[model samples]
Target: MADIERHDYDVIVIGAGGAGLRAAIEARSRGLRTAVVCKSLFGKAHTVMAEGGIAASMGNVNSRDNWQVHYRDTMRGGKFLNNWRMAELHAKEAPQRVWELETYGALFDRTPEGKISQRNFGGHEYPRLAHVGDRTGLELIRTLQQKIVSLQQEDHAEHGDYEARLRVYPECTVTELLLDEGRIAGAFAYWRENGRFLRLEAPTVVLATGGIGKSFKVTSNSWEYTGDGHALALRAGANLIDMEFVQFHPTGMVYPPSVKGILVTESVRGDGGVLRDAEGRRFMFDYVPEVFKGSYADSEQEADGWYSDPDNNRRPPELLPRDEVARAINSEVKEGRGSPHGGVYLDVASRLPAEEIARRLPSMHHQFKELADVDITAESMEVGPTCHYVMGGVEVDPDTAASGVAGLFAAGEAAGGMHGSNRLGGNSLGDLLVFGKRAGAGAAEYVAGLGARPEVSQADVEAAEQRALRPFEESGSAAAQHPYALHGELQQVMNELVGIIRRGEEMSSALDELAELKDRAGHMAVFEGNRQFNPAWHLTLDVANMLLVSECVARAALRRTESRGGHTRDDHPGMDATWRRRQLVCEHRDGAVTVTERTHPPMRRDLLELFDITELRKYFTADELGEVTAEL
Candidate 1:
C-alpha cells in the first residue's frame, strides 16, 4: 500500500518565494484555508538572491514619470512583443504594491527629503525603481516573511483559526498535480527531510515556483530554479508563451568554479558604476543610440551631468536595460577587448565612497570575499553575462493569471507575458507581489465556486508515483549514470547550443542532445545513503523538469525565424513584421509537445481613437491589419 498522508485545504500554493507567500496571505484574507509548499526553507527561495530593487513608478523623486510613461518604457524595453494587458496592469498596480510593502514594515532607502528613494534601471524613461540599496530583494523577502508570520499570529489569536488556514510547509517538494475530471483538484508531494509522500486536496492550485535557469550551465540562479511551475503547468495542459526568450544579466562574477557566476546586481550601475574594457575604453555610448536615442548622452561629461539631473537625461552608465548592456559586453568580448578574466571590468570603486559601497552592496561584498576572496570595495570586479531570469514561461491572461488549463494558475517568473523579451533588473520583486495577489484572488475565486473534484484515474497517480520513486530503485551498473554527471552534460549541451546566440542548426543539435540526455536520465542512479535532504535525489527530479522546459525552449526557438528580444539568431538577425502579429504557444498533449499560434489582442478602441496619445500607445499593440481573423 502507498504511504499516503492526505491534506485538505481550500487552496494550495506551490513555492514559497515572494509570490507564493504573498498569495498565501491574500488567500487567507479571502477566508480560504491556504497551504504554501516549497522546496527550501521559507526565506531561501530565489527571491532572496535577487540583488536589485523593485520597479514601481512611484514618482517619488521623478514627478515626470507616470504609469503611461512606465507602460511605454516597459513595452519598448520588451522590444514591443509584451502582452499589453499584462504590461498595463503591472505598470498601474506596481506603485500601489510598493506602497503596500511599506505598510507591511519594509524599510526602504529614503531620500534626503525622507521619501522613498527611486533609482534608474535599464529602459526606464525616468528614474522609477524603488530600492533598499542593492539588497532590495533580501529586504523585500524578509519584510514579507515577517508580515506573514504576524498575520498568522494575529489570525490565531483573533479567531482561534490557526489550524484551518495559512500553513507554510517548507522543505517539501510537489511531484504532481492531481487533476480530477478536467479541473485542478490537488497535488501530491514528498517531504525532503524524511521522504514521506503528502497529498494535498485543494480546489485551486497556484504555481509561483520561479524560473528555469538551472537548465543552463553558467547561471546566476539558485539551485532551486528548476522550472517546476513551468513543467507542472505543461503536464497539466497549460500553454507556455515566449519560451524562446531567456535573459542573461550582464555583470556576474565569472570565476571560481564553486560559486561559478554570482549576480553582481544592476544597482551597481544604477549607483554610478561604469563598465570598461581592458583598454579602459567605454563602449556603451556606441550601442546606446537606437534604444536610448533621445534619452541617452554621448560623452562622459554628459553622462555624468545626467546623473545629477536624471529628468533631463538617463542616469549612470551600466544602468541601461539588461539587453543593451549584455549585447555590448558580448560585442566587446567577441572583439577580444575583454578583461583579464574574460569579462569586462565593472568599476564602481572609482565612483562611490568605500563606506557607501559596503553599505549598499553588502551581499556583493560577502559573496566576493567568501567565494572568490576578492574585496570588491577596493578593486574593480570582473563580470559578464550569466543565466538569470526567464522572460518566457507558462502563458496566462495577465489579469487573471489563469492558464489555458481550467484549474491551473501561475505567477512570478513561472508565468510569462509581463516582460516580453528582456526583464529589467529590479522589476521582478514588484511583479511577484502584484501578480501574486492577482493569482491568489483568481485561484480563490475559482475555488469558491468549484464543483466536485474532477475524476482522477488510479493509473495517472500510479504513473506519477512510479516516476517519482524510480530514483530510489535504480542500482549501479556499467551503464548506470550518475545524476551529477548527466546534469553537467545537460547543462553544457544547453549552454553551447542554445545560449547567448542561436542558429537553426544549433537548436536542432540541441534538440538531439536533449533527447540523448533524457534517455540517459532513465539509467541515472542517486548516491547511496539516507534520502534525507539528499540533493542528488532532488536533482534527479530537477533534471526531468529541466529537460522538459529546455525541449520547449529549443522547439520554440527553432520555430521563431527572426531575432527579437533576448532571442537573437545570427542566421535570422532582424525582427520580422509578420512574426510580430502573433505569439507561439507551446503545449504538451498526449505526451507530445505541440505548437499553436495565439493572436495578439487588438489595439484598444478607446486608445486607438484618442487623438493626443494614440500613436504613442498604438506602438504598445501589434501592427494593424484592416480585417480581423480568429486564427492568428
Candidate 2:
C-alpha cells in the first residue's frame, strides 16, 4: 500500500537467537523457504551472553546420569509444576540434540577418555552439562550459525544465490503479527537501521524471542529482550501461561553501578565455588528448605567431600536451585550480612586453584577482571539476585510447539510450561536445541498440509505503518511523554514491587502504576531526529510491548497467592500443593490483559513413577496423588 518491501516464505521466524537459528536450520533442511529476523547483528543475539553449559544427559562424566534422573531433577527443580510431557521430551531428547550439534562441527570440551564431557549443575544429580569452558552459549551459537552458512553455501552452489532457501534479516524489528481469520498470515516489521517498513507473508511463524528482563530496573538480560515475542503472541490472540514466574538468578554482579546485574555464570558454583557473607560464613546451609533437606549437605566437611566423592556425600547447599539461592541472598542483604556493595560474596579463590578456576571459567574470570576490576581467582566477588529468565510464555502443544492460534508456534524462553516455575541453569540452551527443532519441523508439517496459503491484507499493512509513525506525530507536542522517562518509570515499578519477592499489595500498586504508564505511552514521543538508527524511536516501540507484557506479569502475580520456585509471595511464604495443580493463563481481550485460572493436565503415570511418593507429596495434592496411583 505504501510501497513497502514485501517477501513470501513458508515460515517466518522472529528473534535470531539460539532457538530462532536452530528452528531456521530445521525448517530449511526440510526443504522449506525460511526467513529469520533479528533485532541485533547476525551472531550478536543474546544467546552469546550465556555462560553456563547446555544441559544434556550424556553420562560421560557420570555413569549414573540418564534421562530418568535428569527428568526427575528437572521436575523437582521446577517444584513439580512443569508440563510433564514437555519435560519428558526435553530430558529424553537433549542428549541427541547436543550430539547433533557435534555433527554440525561443534567442538565441546571432552573428557580424558575422549567423550563429550558433562559438568555438574544445580538440581541435577550428576555431571550433565556439555560445555566449552564457561562460554558454552557462544559455542552453541557459533555452531548453529556455521550450519546455517553451510546451507547457504550449498544453495549458492546450486541456485546462484546464497539465500535461495534460507535468509537472515538482521537489525530488523517486527512490530505486529498480521492474522487472517484467526490464523497467522504474516508479520509487519521495520528495519532498525533505515527505519523502512517490510512485510513477510508466510503460512506459519515461529517465535523465539527470549524474555522480559528489560522491564525490570536491574537485570541480566540485554536491551533486546523486551517481551517482543510474548506481546506479539498475546496481541495475535494466544494465551500465556505462568506469566508471574520470573527467575532472579542467584549470582549477578552487584558492585560497580555501571556493571550491576551482569550475570556471573552458574559455572562458578558448578566448578566448586561457594557463597559466603560479610563475616565469611557459609550461610547457604541454613537456607535449604525442608523439601530439599536430605539432598544437600548440612556441614562444610560433607560439602567439600562431595566435590571429590559425590557418590557418598550430598551436594553443597550453595548449589541449590536458583530461586532458593536468590532468596537466600536477598535475606542476607536485608539482615545486614551483605558485602559492602549490598550483596553476598561468591568465593572461588579458596575452593579451587587459580589456574583451575581460570581453566573452568575463563569467561567469568575475564568478565570480573574487566567489568568490576576484580580478580575472581584471588578474592570473593560481590553478587546478588538479578532478574534473568521468565518461566512464563506462550502456551503451546507439548509435542508440536503450536500455540492456540493455528499457524503460530513458540519455543525457548518465549514458550511456557517447559520449565514450569524455575528453570535449571543449563536447561535454557537445551530448550533452544530441543524445542527449536520441534517448532521448525512442526511448522513445516503445518505448511505441507495447508490447503491455501494465508495472504497479508493491505489494510493491516497500512495500519502497522501508521502505528509505527505515531511517535513522530507526537514529537514536539506540549503533552508528549519522553520514551526514555516512561521506560525508566516502568522498570522501576517492576524492579521494586513485582521483583524477586512479592506481596499482593505491592503488585496491586504495580497494576495501578502500569495502567497510568499505558495511558502515558499513548502520548510517547522521541527527540527530533531522522528515523534511521533513532534509539528513541526504537524504544518507543519497545516501551509499548513492555507495558503490555508487564501488566500480564503484574496481573498474574497478584492472582497467584502462593510461593513456588520463581513466583514467591512474601505474604504467602510456603508452596501450595493445590496451586501447583493450577496455572495462570493470560490473554488480551477487549483491549485489556486478563488472567484466568486453568488446571494443567496430570502428569503421565510412567513419569510419575520416576519420583518417590514422599517427594511427590511435597508438591502434589492428595487428590492428585490418588489420580497418579489410580492411573499407575
Candidate 3:
C-alpha cells in the first residue's frame, strides 16, 4: 500500500465556497474540530463569481416585503415546484443570515437611513437583495474568510496553534468518499500541487461543492464545478432529485468566442436594462406566458415607468424569472432577429447614465471592457442563454440537510429540492448561508450522539488510490484516449441535445451518446507526466465525474416528459399539472444510472395558505387542491 497522510476531524467540509465556510464556522462555534477542503485556493472558490446580491426579505427598500411575500414569490418563480418547507425556511431565515454577515464584519452598501441597501433582481417581487454593489459575491467570500481568520485567532490564543480547532486545506480535491457500513467514514483526496494522497477520517461529511455547470460546453461555471459532490453522493449510495431541471441563465457573453459563456449579471436588467432584438424591439414582452401575463407590463411606457414608480406599474417582462428570459432569447435568435453574434441585445447604457451604470454595476462594466472589449455603459451587449446552474442535486432532508445515507449531508447548490424547477437570482448566496449553518449544526449534533466513530479501512483507501492512478496506468496503452477530447465530446453532447430546450428524442440520443462517452472515459489517459501541478491529469479525473453526472441528467431528462421551469421539453410544450406533483429521482446501481419517478409530499397547509386558490389552480391538480382546501 502507498504511504498516505491522515488527519482526523469531527467534521470534514468538501469545498471552500460560501456554504463550506459557513458550515465550518458553525461547527467550530459549536466546539467541534472541523476541516475545510477545496480544489481552489482559500477565498478563490466560485462563490466569488456571484455578481448578484444575496436575497433576503429585509424590507430595507420596500416596507411591504417580508418572509411570507418572499416565500410566495419563491414558489411562483419555481412555478410551484419548489419544496415548500425549504422555501419557507429560506424565506424566513435569509434575513437573519444577511444580518449575521454584518456581525462578521461584512460591509454592505447602505441606504440613506444607514440600513443595508437592497436591490432588484429577476423573479423577486421587491428590492429584496442585500448587496455590496455588483460584486456582492466577492464581498460575501471576503467576509466569510475574515470570520474564519478570527476563529483561527481565537483558537491560537487558547491552544497556541492557529489550526487547533479549525483548518483549511486548499488545492486539495476529494476523489472518493469512503464509507463504512453505508455510513460516511472519510474522504480520499490528493493535493493538486504535489499529487500526494491524503485521508481525513470523519464520522460526518458536509458536501457544499456547488453545481454541475461545467458538464456543458457553454457555461458560466468555473473549472471546479465538475459535479464533484453530486457524483460523490450518488456513488456513496445517495439519491439525486430533479436531475433533469437545469437552469440556463438568460444573459452570457455571445461575442468573442473565447469568452462566449461568461456570465452577464442580471443586475444589468435589475438596474433598468432591457432586452432588444436586432430590429430594436423589446422582444420579452411578446414571450410572457399566460401564467405570468398580468405580472409584467404590456407596454413600453409602463415598463419604463416601473424604474421610478414600481408601486404603480408592473415590472418589465425582462425582469421575469431566468427561465422565461432565456427561452425568450432563444426564440428571438431562432427567429433571425438576433444580434451579429447569434444573440439578442441587452441594453443598459440607453436606460441609465454612464456614471450610474459604472457605480451600480462596476464588475459587469469591467468584465465587459476587459474580456469582450465592449463598453457596456455605451452600447448594448450581445447576450444569450448559457448553462448557469443545475436545480437538481443530492436529495436531502429539508430541516437537517442530511441525505438518506447516515452521516452524509449536503447544502448549497449541491443539494436538491430547495429550488424545485428554477432558482431566483440572488437566492443562491442566501441558500448557502442558511443551509450551511443547518448542515454544520446537524453534523455536530449527529457526531455528539454517535455511539462509535466510523473508521476508514485500509482496503478502501488502497482502492481509492488505484482508482486515482488508472489514467497513469493507461497512458502507454494503444487503446488509450485523450481526456481533453473525451471531455470536449461530452460537453458538446450535453450542450447540443439536453440543453435549455429539450425533446424526448434528443434526450434519448443524449443518453446514448453519454453511454458511449462513459465507455470512452474508462479508457481516457493523460500524457506521461508527473501528476504534480498537471492540469491534464486533474481533468482526467474530472471527466469521469462529469460523464457520470451527465448520464444522470440525460436519463432523468428523458424520463420527464413535460415542460416546466428548467426542464423544457419542446415535444410537450405545456407544463403538466399532474407532473408538477412528481419528481424525477436519479440513483446509481449496477454500474449504470437509473431514474425513477416519485410524488412530492404535499405542501404544509400553513404554507399553502400563503397563495390564493386561483394561483394554486394553475399548478396543482383538482385532487391536490381539494386536499389542501380540506386541510386548511
Clashes of each: 6, 0, 0
What tens-digit string does per-residue lDDT give for candidate 1 at 82-174?
A: 887888888899999999999999999998899899987777767787888778888888988888788788778987875457888999999
lDDT tens digits, residue span 1-632, model 3: 66799999999999999999999999999999999999999999999999889999999988999999999889998988888889999999999999999999999999999999999898888899999999999999999999999999999999999999999999999999999999999999999999999989999999999999999999999999999999999999999998888999999999999999999999999989999999998888898888886788999999888878859538889999999999999999998999998999999999989999999999999999999889988999999999999989999898989998999999999999888899999999999999999999999999999999888999999999999999988988888989989989989999999999898888889888888888878888877688788898999999999999999898888887888899889999999999998988898897888888899998887888988787788898899888675654
TM-score of 1: 0.94
The C-alpha lDDT values of all candidates are 0.82, 0.93, 0.92
Error of 1 at 105 (Å): 1.3
Q: Assess candidate 1 and give its lDDT.
A: 0.82
Best lDDT among the predictions, by candidate number: 2
TM-score, structure 3 vs. true: 0.99
List candidate 1 segments past 4 Å from native: 158-161, 289-291, 314-317, 455-459, 476-479, 605-632
Which residue pairs collide in model 2, if any? none
lDDT of 2 by residue, 181-293 (tens): 99999999999998999999998999999999999999999999999999999999999999999999999999999999999999899989999999999999999999998
TM-scores across all candidates? 0.94, 0.99, 0.99
Clashing pairs for model 1 are 122-320, 122-321, 180-454, 180-455, 181-454, 181-455
